[model samples]
Target: MIRNTILLAAGAAALFLSGCGEPRAYGKVDKTPYEIRECNKELYRGIDTDPEKHIDKIVVHKKKRELAMYKKGKLIYACKVSLGKNGDKGDKVQAGDYRTPEGSYRIVRKKCDPRLYKSLMISYPNAEDKARARANGVKPGGYITIHGQPKWNADGHADRFTLAHDWTEGCMAVSNKAIDALWIAVKNGVKIDIYP
Candidate 1:
C-alpha cells in the first residue's frame, strides 16, 4: 500500500510540472522585443551626418505629417512628426483649439532643457495670425514649438508610437534623436513654414 501511494504521488508531481503544455496569459501582451524596446539608446546616437553644418529653414507639411530641415534652400533632413490632436479640423484660430497654425513663423528660441527632450520655439502669432484671431474675437494661441519626444518617450523608442496618432496640443513633435540633431544644427531666428 505504501509503495502504491508513493508511485501515485510521483505521477501527480510530474503532471503538475508539465504545466498543461503551455502557460496561460491574460489581457494584452506586449510583443515588442527587448532590443526594440530599448531602441532609442541603440539608434541615432552618433553623428553620421556633417556635424558642422547648420539649417536655415524648416518646413512642416501638416497633411503629410512631416518636418523637413533645410540649409540654403537645399533639403538636408526630414523626419516624421506628430501634430495637434485636432489638426484635421484645420488651422488654429483660437487658444486651446488644438490645431497647428498655418503660415510662416520664426524659431525664436531654443530650449536645451524643456518638458520634452528639447525644443525650438516658434513665433506662432505672426501678424496675420493675430489679426485673424482679433477679428474673430478669439485669442491666438502662442508658445508653439518644434520639439522632441516627451519625457515618457525618453530615448525615443515610443516615437513610432507617437507618430501613429496625432498627439500634440499644437506643437510639432519629433524623436529625441532628431531633436538632438536639430538642437545642434538649428539656430534661433530660423524661418519655418507650417503648411496645411
Candidate 2:
C-alpha cells in the first residue's frame, strides 16, 4: 500500500512538472519548408522576356525568408532568400545601414559580376525613401540588388559557406543556381514588392 501511494505521488509530481514546462509538439516536424524546383533547360537559355507565361511581379516576405514570382497575379515560382543582416527590424534608411528596404521597387539594371554572380539591381531610395531619410536627417542609401552567391572558385561554382546566412550590406541574396534561373526568368522593369 505504501509503495502504491508513493508511486501515485511521484506520478502526480511528474505530471505537474510536465505541465509547468514549455509545451512541445508531438508530431513529425518538417525541417525544410521551402521547395527548390529543378532548373530546366529554359532557365539556362538566354534571357527571353516575352514568354507566354512570364513572371511580371516579384514578392518578398522578409520574415518568412521567401521570394515568390507571380505571373499575371498567379504564383509561378518561389525560393528561399536571405536579406541584410539587419533587415529584420525595418526599412533601410541610410548608407551602410545594412537593412533591406521595405517597399515597391523595380529592377532598374541587370549586372553580371564574374565573382559575385548575377545581380538584379533594385531601385531603392524611391521618393518615399528619400522623404523618410530627409525627415530622419540621414542619407538614403543606394545600390540595392537581388543577387546570388559569390564565385569563390569558378564562374558556375559558388562557395556554399558564403550563402549560408544573411550577410549582405543591403541586398537580397539567393543561390548562384537560383540567380541563373532568375536572370533568364525576370527582366528589366519588373516590379518587386518587399514586405516585412
Residue 22 of model 2, lDDT score: 15
Candidate 1 least-lDDT 10 residues = 14-23
lDDT tens string, model 2, 20-109?
Answer: 011245464332111111222323454334465457999999989888888888888788787776878788888877789999999887
Residue 190 miss distance in model 1 (angstroms):
0.6
- The RMSD (Cα, Å) of candidate 2 is 16.0
* Regions of candidate 2 where Cα sits further than 4 Å from its true position: 1-50, 153-164
| C-alpha TM-score for every candidate | 0.72, 0.70
Pick by TM-score: which candidate is best? 1
